[model samples]
Target: MKSTVEQLSPTRVKLNVEVPFEELSGDFDRAYQALAQQIRVPGFRPGKAPAKIIEARVGRQAILEQVVNDALPAKYSQALAESETNAISQPEIEVGDLVYGEPLTFSAVVDIRPEITLPDFATVSVEVDPIEISEADVEDQLEELRQRFGTLTAVERGVAEGDFVTLDLSATVDGEPVEDAATEGLSHEVGNGELIEGLDEAVTGLKAGETATFTTTLVAGEHADSEAEVTVTVQSVKVRELPEVDDEFAQLASEFDTADELREDLRRQVSDSKKYEQAGAIRDAVLESLLESVEFPLPEKVVEDEVEATQHQLVHALGHDDEQINRFLEAQGKTREEWDAEAKDEAEKSVRTQLLLDAVADEAETEVGQDELTQQIIMQAQRYGMPPQEFIQQLQNANQIGALYADVRRNKALAGVIGEVTVKDTNGDVIDTATFFGGNDDAEAEAEGDDA
Candidate 1:
């Protein structure tokens, strides 16, 4: 067997493979054995027919086809390994002349990872928003906490902002009632706008037993993207009465005993949250900078697959209803053309990022330990609301453990280079990347042991 590679482009290659008749002996044996089990002979029991008799009955073409089908995958894999090509897409195979007693020849065109020249990490600089928590921020948190513990009191007055209302809603399109759009005794916040558009304004200032009619486009279901007349009848109105901010209130809302202490704790929490946001921003900025610094051609099929998969998921999430998709796009203020363009751009960028990070991992000699892979699986499981063991089993079933390993390797590679890059805050203060992004060997070991 012999194989040679032809570079078709920066991101694609063609492989020419030739196998002598002697080299295909094993394939032939397996093909003949398989055929013996399926074909019946008068004098022989099932699966007991000789290869020569079966070949004479089934014809040489049948055996050759079976041999080609059985040998193509393994031979292609061997060829790829010999050529040292990292293919990203399935190969397009073409068979050549296949005369008896001659060599079996074939060619495969596949997409491969392009070579990328990475820039000096130390030369990259990115500025992120400074972490700042103010009194207003703490107050906002406190307000939300207060709202959670607030009591609702029935009010005889008309509905207003911040008021809760129980109402019956019905919609009609072209004088025909929409059953799915009708509901009774639905509880809603007057100004929340969690429901349909123009609902907040239509429901405001309506007293008990009063009805208000408004027009808005339906956002989901069969009638989505169509304008309808919505009638909302207020059954009752209630106002939220917030508890006074005092020591007693603090004790009820939190473990803290005093309002001042609770406020201080809230401030710390807000500051920590801001730090996380800043860290995320820094990561995004660094990745964008890295992408801009490198240039490489992306596999066209890979990008197309990514885009198609993403679009399919988006549409599926909308129940595969065209009207629902239109309404969603309208809400996002995007047209179909604009969305397609954006999806393609995003897909290209995603492919480029993955390829670049993979190269970086190779250059840095990044290795994903068993513990790190397990930790990643655990984290992803938590995000999907599944047990770690169950998620691991699912990954194994889907043969995606390699994907998880690659993700961890890429993340570690990025972390290894983050400290080399210069990071500063918007206020020009040099930030400590190691403090936030660096890995703690001791902590990681302890966590891994706990997980085990």
Candidate 2:
């Protein structure tokens, strides 16, 4: 058996393999065994017929066909291993005619990972928004806390902004009632704008027991993307009455003993939240800088697969309903062609980023520990509102655990570069990335050892 590789392009390769007749004994044995089970012969039980007898009964041509079919996959894999090709996509295999007592020849064309020239990390620079906590930010937090402890008082006036209302809703399209669009005893905030379009405006200025009718386009259900007349009846309107920000109110609402102390704590909380946002912004800016500095050929097949996967997810959510998909596109003001083009562009960017990070991980010799992988899994489980154990089980069932491992590695690789690059805030202050990236793991481990 022998194999050689041909560089078809920067991102693709072709492998030519030849397996002599002597190397195919295993393939022949398996094929004969399979054929023996399917063919009946005189004076022999099922699967008991000799290879020669079975071949004679089925004809040499049939035996050879079975052997070729059974041999291709293993031969292709062996060729890949021997040639050390980094295939990123499935191969398109072509087999030549089999001559008796001659070596079997075949060729496979596949997309390969492209060589990338990584930029110097120390030269990369980015700027992010500075973390600034304002008086208004603290006051906003205080207001939210007060609202949580506020009481809802029954109001004898019309619905107004900041008022909570309990209502009943129903809708009809062309005088035909939309069954799924009717609900009773629904609670809504007047200015929230979370429900149907024009709901807030139509319900405002309407007192209890008054009904207002407005038109809206249905986004889901039987008449999706169609205009429907919606009627909302205000059952009751109530306003929230918040307590004054005094020492007594502070004691009642929080653990703090004074209103000033409570306000100070709220200010600290706001600062911490802003710091988190700034960290995220810095990470994004750094990644953008890296992407702008690097250039490499992307595998077209990989990008196509990503786009197809995105489409599959949407189709699965809609239960394979193309009409619902079209309605969704209409609601977003996008044509099918435009949406497809956008998907392709997004896929290209995504693939490029993954390849870049993968190369970085390779160059850095990044390793993911058990604890880091577990932490990532727990974080993902929390985001999806599932138990960690259940999420792990699902990942194992879907065989996505490896993909998750790669994702974590890629993330760590990107984070590892943060300490080497220069990051500054918009206020011209140098940013300390160690505060967010957790610093070098080796240094931390050394410190722990010293403490021990």
TM-score of 1: 0.91
Candidate 1 — what's its lDDT? Answer: 0.90
lDDT (Cα, tens digit) per residue for candidate 1, span 136-202: 9999999999999999999988789989999899999999999999999999988877999998898
lDDT of 2 at 257: 98
Highest lDDT, which number? 2
Candidate 2 structure quality by residue, lDDT tens digits, 1-452: 89999999899999999999999888888888888888899999999999889868888877787788888999999999999988888899998898767889999999988999999998998998888888999999999989998999998898899899999999999999999999999999889888998999999999999999999998777787789999999999999999999999899988999999999999999988998898889888888898899989999889999999998898899888888788778778999999999999999999999999999999999999999999999999999999999999999999999999999999999898887789998888999999998686766789999999
Q: What are the Cα lDDT values of the candidates?
A: 0.90, 0.91
What's model 2's lDDT at 354?
90
| Residue clash pairs of candidate 1 | none
Which ranges in model 2 have alpha carbons more than 4 Å from their true place? 30-48, 54-71, 98-101, 246-261, 441-452
